[model samples]
Each structure stands twice: as structure tokens, then as C-alpha cells.
Target: MKQLPLPMHLPARDGFDALVVGRNDHAVAHLRGLVPGAGVAAPVYLWGDAGSGKTRLLRALAEQHQAQGERIGWFDAGTALPWTLDEGWSLVVVDRCEALDAAHQQAAFALFVEAGTQGVQWAAGGRLPPVDLPVRDDLRTRLGWGHVFALQPLAEGETRAALRREADRRGILLPDEVLAHLLTHHDRDMAHLMAVLDRLDGFSLAEKRHITVPLLKKMMAENIHDLVPNPPPAP
Candidate 1:
């Protein structure tokens, strides 16, 4: 079997403008207000299902602050560094709160306390609401102490439209059949769909093939071991 090249990391389409609002307009608006001089000073906690743009929003806010040369403290459940509070930080962002282990939770709680004392603007995201998070009681309460927003997944039509727009933006001539196949055969989440599209586009370019159903299937077949549950028999 011919070895297929992996898709390189595509620049994420993250930012307030890139977000597909769907039913998350209010959440987006509130998040936008988190930037300095937006007149909204409360911390925010966002809860949603997978691929509901929680990470996107958090990253967007971080980017916005970073663009203005503000110091940012970003902590995620996967971070190897201790979640210590930095007094010089102008903004703080915490992601994947639900995945935090005992040590991370304790550190996060302390960071939260210090951030509160220093009036540092902060935001966090999790898969579950603060009330339902399986973390320490005090930390859970702190997660809910400010504005809480529930992000909604884009509807099917909305997702299709967004995909089409992305394709157009990328100058890829995405056919209907390819779009339908993606919707039916792959994960329906926007993030996953976008990643697949990115891979497909890269594959098409490397192979000098038109973006067709056959080409899509061929790419998937060549990359099956990387993409799906079962790998095809070795040639």
C-alpha cells in the first residue's frame, strides 16, 4: 500500500468573525465583551457538547488579548505546567475543566482565587454545566460564579452552509456529492468536518485530482488506518 501523507496543521478559523453563530449569538456577544474596554467585567463559564465551539471562543478571546499585547495566562487540563496564578496576567483562560485531575483541580481553584483577588479577567469551558462538573465543590461553585452560557451545535442546514462557505473561502470546488458523503460518513461535528475537508483538500492537491466522490473515497481508503476504526488489509 502506498503511504499517504498526513495533513499538516491547518490554521484554525478561530475568532469572533469566524464563528458560526447559530443559536450562540448571546454567548458570542458576551465573550466578545470580555476584551478590555468592552465594559463587561464578569468572568464567563461556557458549557456545551463536543465541537460546540467552546475552545474556539476561548482561543478567540485569547488571541484578541494577545493582539493588543496583553499578558495572558492560559491553562488547560492537558497542561504539564502547574496552574499557578500569574499576577502580571491581564487575562486568564481555562479549558477542559471537566478533564482536570485532582492536582489540576486544586491548582485551578487556587488560581481562580488569586485571579479574583487581582481582578484578572478570566474565562473557562467545560463539557458539562458547573453544577454537574465532577470537581471540588468550591471549584464548581466558582465556575458558576459568573455569567454562564450554553453553546448550541449548529443545525444541519447551518452546518452545510458553513461548510460551503469555508470551501468557497478556500477556493475549493466542493461538489454536492462530496459534501453529502462527508455529512453522512464522518463525524457531524463542525471541527471534525473542517479537519476532514482540510485533509481532503490537501490530498487532492498532492494527487492533482479533482475533488470528486471517487477521489474522496480514495483518500479515505489510503488514510483509513489513520482515520477510521479498522484498517484495510495490508497490500
Candidate 2:
């Protein structure tokens, strides 16, 4: 197969206000939109199902923003900021933007608008588009004023490719047969797959063995064989 671009950046630490997305195709594009004229729609707003890689893309964007020497501040809204948001920061990122209750939602929206003029570019993620939001007017309009993009869930094909790519990243030689089995029988979630892969990766490294069908079988038996029925009689 041809080489694909790197699976996109993963944040080392998750600031509460920002999101961490997965290896979905939209990751880099979403990050690039942060630069207003970087050939992406401006004032980008991302929407996606829960666990659909929204946070990961947000994190990638945060990484790019930080790389360019821009300061990014995160606000969960649920947590009160000890100081005013008027502090010096070029980017203010908020996730679960919908979590703000009605009474204070307008104040939150005003902050977003204020942040923009204050040299802080704002990006937020929520399930509904700002136009569709029924929250406070200022907040809803503020959300709608920017570019709005929704993240689609990864297809099975994409998920499988992600698995293979991750295995390569860890220097684990996942047998083609074992890879096929895992992708076919297990959950179609990249997040879940990665979580389990870490365990498999560590095991393979400790044993000084490449990932093989037998090794997978043994690992699964010790841990998650119950996840996949029968598991093809264990090779």
C-alpha cells in the first residue's frame, strides 16, 4: 500500500477546555483551519457524535497552535476560572460547549466574542451547530459566526488501516491474519482498539517476540478472548 501521511498529532496532556481527537482523516484539516487563511473555512466549529474522534482533532489543532508559539487557554465552563479570561492568550479553546446552562450561557458567549477582538482566536466543539442551538442568543450567535464542521465516524476500512498503522508505529509486527481477525471481530472503535493495542505492544516487547497469530491468541486468552467469540479456534 502507498504511504499515508502521519496519523496526525496526539496531545501529551489534555487541558480541560480542549479536546483530543483520534487518527481520523479530518484531523489535520481541522488543525489547519486554525490559521484563518490556511485554505480552510474560518471561525471553525466542529460537531460530532460522542467518541467520534472530535477531541483528537481538537488536540491536534492545539498542538499546531502551540507549535506556532501561540498561547492557548482552555475553559470547561463547569470549572470557574479564578481569573478573568481577558488575560493574554491568542487562542481560547472550549469543548462540550453545549454544557453551559442557560443563565450564564450568554456571558460565556460574550466572552468568546470578546476573546476574538482581544487577539484570542476561539474554537469550540459541540453536537449541534450554533445556529441550531437554543441556548442564550449571544452564545448561539457567537457559535454560528464561525466555520462549522462536523466530524464523521471512521468507516470500518479506515479503522482497520488505523490498526495496522498503529502496530507499525510501535514496531510491532502484527501478522496479517491476526490483524484481520481483530478488525473483523472486535469493536469498530479506534479508541478501544488503541487502548488494547498498548497492552499487546507492551507484552510483545517484553517477550522479545513479534506479534503473531499465536501470540495474539495467547494474549487474548489471558485477557480478552471473551471479546471475540470462538476466535477461529486459536490458529
Q: Model 1: per-residue lDDT, tens digit, 112-208?
A: 8888888888799999999999999999999998999999988888888888888877788999988899888987777788878888888887887
Model 2 lDDT, residue 18, Cα: 33
Instruction: Residues 1-235, candidate 2: write the lDDT tens digits.
Output: 3232343434234332233223444544555656632432345577777646656666666677677676677665575644257465666777777776664475566677677666667777776667776577767777877677777776666666767766665556777787787777567555666766766676565566777777767777777754442367544
- What candidate 1 gets wrong by more than 4 Å, as runs, is 1-10, 38-40, 229-235
- Candidate 1 lDDT at 87 equals 68
Give the CA lDDT, 0 to 100, for residue 94 in model 1.
89
Clash count for each candidate, listed in order shown: 0, 7
Reference-based TM-score of each model = 0.89, 0.67
Highest-TM-score candidate: 1
Q: Which ranges of candidate 2 are over 4 A from the true structure?
A: 1-30, 36-42, 77-86, 101-107, 131-134, 206-209, 212-235
